[model samples]
Target: MKGWRARLGFLVPPGNPTVEPEMQALAPQGVSLHFTRMTASGPAGTHEGQEERNRSQIDSIESCSALLAMVSPQVIVMAHTATSYTLGSAAEAALVARIEQLSGTRFITAFGSVLAALEHLNVRRIAYATPYNEVTTLQGKRHLEEQGIEVVSYGQLANVRNIYEENDERAYAIARAVDRPDADAVFLSGVGMPTLDALQVLENDLGKPVISAASAMMWNALRVAGVQHSHSGYGRLLS
Candidate 1:
């Protein structure tokens, strides 16, 4: 049977094209991935007007979660990373609690999963890369610092017309450029930009852990659903 192990659900932004493909490619055997586009849109291409976009997704969460809950997925993920950045830690906690209560299923955010993955790996410092503008990129840095994860070095993609249109080669180049000798890992901090195909290659060249929002989310989703996993040829977070 499909999803014999677990059925994972994701609510992503309508403009995003990377999350489903990246996550589904890395999901374990018997684990099925289901997705629904949340009522989220704004200044497309770049993450312009993202605060409004985040709020739109938050305002629409209950209905979206309710609709997603109909499928009875073992876990539901709020797959946008910027929403957590906009909401901050305390608000995000409350949001997760409320979503869990309303959905009758556990809910996690992309940043939450990335934080869990970083903690599990004992990474104190990360070389961060994102497809956001300088403002949103610094916001993500601040978010991580608040949780005690230091961003030793960080940069955003050059002239990123749209994050969803980014390819693995660009993701790879930015990560490699931002990686630091002192950092424990390289973190690609956006769900829209593709990273799965570059994670292992980045790790090989840098000789350390490489993680993305996409990789971290899928890794944590499998764990939250009580699935035993040891995926190889991926980054350390999954293996």
Candidate 2:
């Protein structure tokens, strides 16, 4: 670890294989990202047991917070967007406080990061796309609305089962599915639903800013790490 730059730690799901590589590609020259995996994969099992999946996510934060303390990294990154969305505002704030108190390090979550990116970009009206079910997708919309961002229109692929099987084709399809003419900016939600590779393609075709969960997470991480690199190829958040 000698002469190495600041390390950003991500608490990601064991099944998630996208965020780390996306962050690495978007990270600045001096920053390195290390991840600590949790048992969370996705919130879907049987048709009637979806609630159980949500319950499982709450268990990861404390362990992740403890794991982050071992590395003594400059920042702790929460890579799960669903956890923040599922837990709501008050709980999310408390989670951050608990992590900071436990690790004595700065922390950022995907949901919080996207909100920050929306603020930095001055995005008021937004269109959203996700691979989650209607219930979960609406929950995310409500969360953003509570933060004063207007979700004009939203689309979901409605893939409630086997979320790990989601690939680039689904992300690109959802990106197209959610693109509406009335929205000022677009938000591609769901950390497990891949979208980083198709962001530029979506933005180019849509002719507006497109913010994905992974891109916003990386932007927020770098900002928290105090890196000043002006990244290109991601979105206006990076540029």
Overall lDDT per candidate, in order of appearance:
0.89, 0.79
lDDT of 2 by residue, 183-215 (tens): 888998877777777777778888988998898
Best by TM-score, which number?
Answer: 1
Candidate 1 lDDT, tens digit per residue, 6-36?
9899998878888887887888888888888
**Which one is best on lDDT?**
1
How many clashing pairs in candidate 2?
Answer: 0
Cα error, candidate 1, residue 94 (Å): 0.6
What does the lDDT come to for candidate 2?
0.79
Query: Could you estimate the TM-score for every candidate?
Result: 0.96, 0.91
Candidate 2: clashing pairs of residues: none
How high is the lDDT of residue 126 in model 2?
A: 94
Off by over 4 Å in 1: 1-3
